[model samples]
Target: MSVANSVSEISPRPSIEGIVEITRADMDRVNALILSMAGSNVELIPQIAEHLISSGGKRLRPMLTLASARAFDYSGEGHVKLAASVEFLHTATLLHDDVVDESALRRGRTTARMIWGNQASVLVGDYLLGQAFKMMVEVGSMRALAILSNASAVIAEGEVWQLSAAKKMSTEESDYMAVIEAKTAALFAAAAEVGPVIAEAGEPAIAAMRRYGMALGLAFQLVDDVLDYGGSADALGKNVGDDFREGKITLPVILAHRHADAAEQQFWREAMEGGSNDDEALARAMELMARHGALDETKHRARAFGAQALEALDALADTPVRSALADVVDFCIDRIN
Candidate 1:
């Protein structure tokens, strides 16, 4: 199906809100923990880390960690450490991603690599990863370490896989799903799962939270791909068509390419391989995607993943935390910037 047709087939869901309503104390504690954990001895390393860390981010991963713990009725302070750990891991990945993608802007600000150079970004990324592990050890839970270590490995593997798969016309939905699940969903799953584990919740509850995180992560990435094509530059914090220019085959383009005929396929091939930014070429590609309904199809997949994320919340009793988590799924989908 084409992107436009896929979008036309599904009714839009209601918007959810109130994702950032944690108590002042909880916010302060998490902030302090993140700041302390991000601190470093090497001046340049700390500077580079701050360039990205201090930049405004939604801090969604840490929020997931906190929300999961609260949903399980955890009243203890340990969630702070775990939340900080999750943020560290996330920041580390962003640093590396900017380097790998040669991204100049993130969150409407210059990326660390853009400001400090790739060498510094890479080293600081490594430092942040090391600090994350150290924080995990301080948590003194072998289980936490095991979970985060596995997540880190999966994230690394996903990054390598994505690099290897770049611009490959043969890339399929299954392959794309694997890469997103590994790179994006793994950390989210680990972040949510850690909360239940720390609270000593049973396997069923942990699994439910993991499902929620995984689905949410998938939804997040799918919508992100859509935004790359359709979002505004100011809203998205980067130029539209950046992904196409980078020659990365995200879900929408991949789906469209699949349905395209021989001539259309040749257009995609040249676009992916030729690095041409001619407006006429881009418009032609967009028109083909619209005609085939690939964009809409990709949106449907994103919505389905979001619905699954909400369903996972069924295991938890109604609470502000669960409501916020549900809201986050919608926010991921509808975010204009």
Candidate 2:
């Protein structure tokens, strides 16, 4: 049963908090399961895991899993397990990300790698992946396991690809898009798809969920990119210009580079590629992005993807859950607005 065509008929967006409220009970279960599964007799293992897990964030990925299962009317406990697995996968990635990025902060607090050291962070991440796979196995769903495992591999490839392409002036918009699709969107698609698969929802439903998540994830990351240039530190939970400091080749940089003249291009090359990214340089970069309307264009692209996500939601029944999910698309894009 596909409702893709009815997407245009759904009007108004709900609040993100409302959507979260709808899944609160299920999320509580997922949280408890996460805590239980993260435990190990190894002291540092649990310590690191607990540090990252207990830190404050929206927990959007696992919530997506739970809400997706609810949208499909799944009544079994399998969705709970899958939601925990999704969170474990997400947490593992964050641990590794901080190490790779040499990031000191995450979600307005010190990164696990910052306090615990890189080695402990990396090993704990591996432990979480081991636990994620175990939970997936416990679900008795081979297809769900395959989807998540494949996403995990693709995400790793995307990370390495981004590293190789970082701060390269020649990097195209398409190249960056492909990287985000894999690194950020693949797990989202898998997380949402697993819910319906566990529910034995048909192929069409699975496809719809995948599309919805893919588009939402794209919008989510694009907004994050925009926020890196424009958002306040309080809103971002990390310092503004983190992407600039890291020389990440995000969409804003790609757009600005395309519009820049030779001298402006030289500025980008020095600031981003040559690692001359001091505060003065970052200020100049922001000026360039504003001058070229890079931030506006990136937000426009994010809205386009947000619309795609909403359209994908039409494949499901026209229920409050679907409506709330649509609101999530709005909420993600609204971060930049």
TM-score of each candidate structure, all chains considered together: 0.92, 0.95
State residue 166's C-alpha deviation in candidate 2, in Å: 1.3
Q: Which stretches of candidate 2 lie over 4 Å from their true place?
A: 1-14
lDDT of each: 0.84, 0.91
Task: State how far residue 180 of model 2 sits from its true place (Å).
Answer: 0.4
- Candidate 2: clashing pairs of residues: 3-314, 3-315
TM-score of 2: 0.95
C-alpha lDDT of residue 79 in model 2: 87
Writing each residue's lDDT as its tens digit, candidate 1 over 140-218 gives: 8788789989999999999999998887878888999999999999999999999888888889999999999999999
lDDT of 1: 0.84
Report how far off residue 272 is in candidate 2 (Å). Answer: 1.0
List model 2 lDDT by residue over 139-165, tens digit each.
999999999999889988998999899
